[model samples]
Target chain A: GEEVAQTPKHLVRGEGQKAKLYCAPIKGHSYVFWYQQVLKNEFKFLISFQNENVFDETGMPKERFSAKCLPNSPCSLEIQATKLEDSAVYFCASSPPHFVAKNIQYFGAGTRLSVL
Target chain B: SQQGEEDPQALSIQEGENATMNCSYKTSINNLQWYRQNSGRGLVHLILIRSNEREKHSGRLRVTLDTSKKSSSLLITASRAADTASYFCATDISGNTPLVFGKGTRLSVIA
Candidate 1:
């Protein structure tokens, strides 16, 4: 697909277990974003990366959620000590070097996480 | 939270009719974008209207942004059954800011 590729279409984890999801951005894209969608509701921004550097992580919950987009590696979002509230669809998106006019982002199919 | 709030959380319309969804936000935005999500799929960008622009169109989809009122609207003309999906509006305050999305409107286009 020409779109972002997300791994583990669906994930199941215990309350205290760890869950990690990976995303591969489209070729040549320099920006990556992570969002969490609950049911069919609004999207919550978790973090963003500009190539290998963290762009904005103010939305990240400082305690358990962490994400990285390292060189030669797929972007990954990890949830440590997952809770029931962590259950949701995690979406990954990517965009070319954003210049306002080229700010359109493409999204992945998302990884549905079920924390029991 | 600077998240946008969409009006008429749900809309039901017959095919061939026009459907409109509105979104209001609390902060100044660089641009407002509309996206569509079908069932459990990821959101696909529909249209984007910059803060300095009023309207834009792509096929049967039209998007209007009113920066003064901090609101925007997405209109799907001559809607089809395939247009049934959840529509969301996302806003960004700056080029580098992360987008804050609206709660979305579940639009049902009945055949």
Candidate 2:
């Protein structure tokens, strides 16, 4: 695939319930990143992966948020015990190897999560 | 945390008019890139300017980066109604890290 693909265009979860989102990065892309956007404002980086290894997790909340990228499978982000503050659009992006000259990232349509 | 802040927050212009947006960052960067997002859509890459490059042009879009001031500006020439979207400036600090995005500028091109 030439573009990143995200599953469940919209997801609704009750407070304290678990929510999961999925993303399939572009074919051959080695870097995958997740970001959260609230109120259509600035994007908050959640996590990033280089191939199947975690490249950066500093922006992720360790308590209830977890993510994984395994070979031959789409990456996943799961939130346990969702809160109202967790309501936002989750975007997944993929970029080619960092060694490439440009650092451009291709984004998915995003999953809009609503915590009731 | 966001490192870039966009100016004006929002803007409106008649079709065919040029629109410009500014962004300022708090730290040095390896490159600055612009992205456009239509309502409820994925972001579209606009242009990217390296730290050493001062300006770049692609079709109707022009990007200028001033490393000394840690600021960048995007200009859209002859805007169209379909061009109405939020514009964001993202900075790559080390080229390998995730980009830090700004709040973004909402531009409405009225037909």
Candidate 3:
């Protein structure tokens, strides 16, 4: 069984400030994904990383959101100049290289972002 | 946008009963997955059925896929009070766009 862990269960930030969330994938997993759940409803794709390289960022808001999966440190998704609409629960999920389709996915509890 | 849409936005059932949720997608997929989210928490992957497969099972959970219909369904038998949660279907649309999820079915299982 694999586990994906996210930090800072809740966050509060001003509208113009920056928000950064962290995720730690399982010990051997290679792919890390970030998704935003607005008001605990629809999940909006953000970005995904395969190891240290970003594989797909089409869903990410290039101007405001960015993510990094550096070695040693846990993966991170940062939003610069956060807005009111950015208030949502950001989930971090990880899957093994070949398991994205069939292998069981592991998700962290999530980080609730509140932009005032 | 190849989003998975779920049927019966909400459902209510009693304990020891079976809970079934259906999901329909817009396009072809490499595989379709079902996930469970408890309240405000993140999603927990329940099962993943490949495109070529018709049915899959894990414990009391059952998942069936129909490529022609572009649909899937998840069945949980002997439901319990703790099974009350939002069940969602996420489709792996054979690309790098990440998994697209449905609106989910809010299930309330009464004891």
Candidate 4:
């Protein structure tokens, strides 16, 4: 695909329920990133992968947030025991190899998560 | 924590006027890129400027970077109502690291 794809345009989950989101990077892109936007404001970087390998996890919350990218499958971000504050838009982005394209990312339409 | 902060949280302009937004970062960056988001949609990449480069232009968009001041500005010339959107500035501290985005500036182009 030419654009990064994200599933579940809107996810409504009860508080404390588990929530999962999926992202498929653009074809031929090696880097995938996840970001969380709250109140349509600042984007908080969550995690990143390079070809199914974890490139950076510094932004992830180790307690209940986990993510994975496996070969032949779309990457996944799962939040366990979701809280009211967890409601926001989750965006997925993909970029070509840094050496080749200088880290310009292409974004998906994003999934709006609502925890009530 | 966010690395960049955009000034003028919101702006209103009549169509056909120019709109300018400013961004200031706290640390050195390898490159700075601007993105626009329309209402509930995802962000669209606008333009990118490298650390060593001072300015760049693409169509109706112009970007300027000053590493010494750790600031950048985006100019939208002859804007239209379709140009109304929230603009963000993201910084790439390292070539391979995730980009750190600013809070964004919301611009409303009234017709």
Candidate 5:
């Protein structure tokens, strides 16, 4: 298995529709992070999880975005009422737990979501 | 504001030449990392420099960190066409904090 796996390499949805993205972290890695990149620009941190528990989510856009990671299941980020502005490539990354958290993330091939 | 900002948004060089990229940050950090992303691909981790380490070398890659200056630089020796890609610098500011990435520097190596 790959270090990190993201489902649906490309997703297309109409405005106001829902978009769901899934990620499978590497085995033995407990930390997961999600990022959004638009138009080849900088990566924007969206959320992170530590072993199925939400660790930090300050960057999440609250109105229409949510995410979850359950034990034995792939972590998922769901966006409701997708807007044209929401179009971007979503990336998933994972890292092993360390005492000092000098985390070196392993990223998955992103899922490019296009909102029409 | 972005925590890490990379200078020279893009660079072009001939094969076998050296390529160097610099990054600056605005805050204290636990560590800094460099990653490479090919077109339409996931980022590939290149190197990680801790706050206490000044320099590290792996193969043809050399990385230097200046904690006092809140900056870092990555130098790749003998650049190859295969090395062409976008390079990004990410900062780990604190424990359990998400990495803040810079707008990448696009490197184009001419064969």
Candidate 6:
């Protein structure tokens, strides 16, 4: 069994401020992902990384959001300017197989971000 | 685009009753996975069925996949109140694409 650990269970930020979230994947996993859940809606993918390199960032909002996975370190998602719409629970996931979408992913408890 | 759509947005059943949820997808997939979310907690993987497989079972959960119809169903037998949660179906298509999740089915198990 494996786990993805996320820090800062909850966060509160004023509008226009920045918010940063962290995710530590299972030791052997190579693929990491970030998602946003707004209420009961389905999770929306934000970005994915393979080790320290980003694999896909198509779902990211380039003007304000960025994510990186530093060597030997967990991944991080940073939103430079927060907005009312940014209030949601953020999830992190990891998969052991780097290039296979079929690989089952493990998820973290997530960071609940509230933007005022 | 999200590939899966779950039907019967909500369900309420008594204990000992079997609860079933259906899901339909728009595209071909490498595999389909079912997950359960207990309120604000993270999603817990329930079962995964590959495109080549027809039926799979784990504990009290049974999953049936029909590639021809591009649909799947998850059945929970002898459900309990602890099983009350939001269940979602996700699709892993193209081998490398990120999993796209459906809106989910909210099931409430009454004692």
Please provide, for model 6 over B1-111, each residue's C-alpha lDDT reduced to its tens digit, 9 standing for 90 to 100: 667899899999999999999999998888899999998899998999999999999999999999999999999999999999999999886554588999999999999
Each model's interface RMSD (Å)?
1.4, 0.9, 2.5, 0.8, 1.3, 1.6
Off by over 4 Å in 5: none
* lDDT values, one for every candidate: 0.90, 0.95, 0.88, 0.94, 0.92, 0.90
Q: Taking chain A of candidate 3, what TM-score results?
A: 0.93
Q: Chain A alone, TM-score for each of the models?
A: 0.96, 0.97, 0.93, 0.98, 0.96, 0.93
Runs in model 3 with CA error above 4 Å? A99-103, B95-97
**For candidate 6, what is the TM-score?**
0.95
- TM per candidate, chain B: 0.96, 0.97, 0.95, 0.98, 0.95, 0.96
On lDDT, the stronger of 4 and 5 is 4
| Cα distance off (Å), candidate 2, residue A82 | 0.5
Task: Return the number of clashes found in candidate 2.
Answer: 0
True contacts kept of each: 0.64, 0.84, 0.64, 0.80, 0.74, 0.64
Write down the DockQ of candidate 4: 0.85
Model 2 CA deviation exceeding 4 Å by range: none
List the DockQ of the predictions in order: 0.71, 0.85, 0.61, 0.85, 0.75, 0.68
lDDT of 1 at B101: 92
Report RMSD (Å) for each prediction in the order shown: 1.2, 0.8, 1.9, 0.7, 1.3, 1.7
Model 1 is docked with a DockQ of 0.71
In candidate 1, stretches whose alpha carbon ends up further than 4 angstroms from where it belongs are none
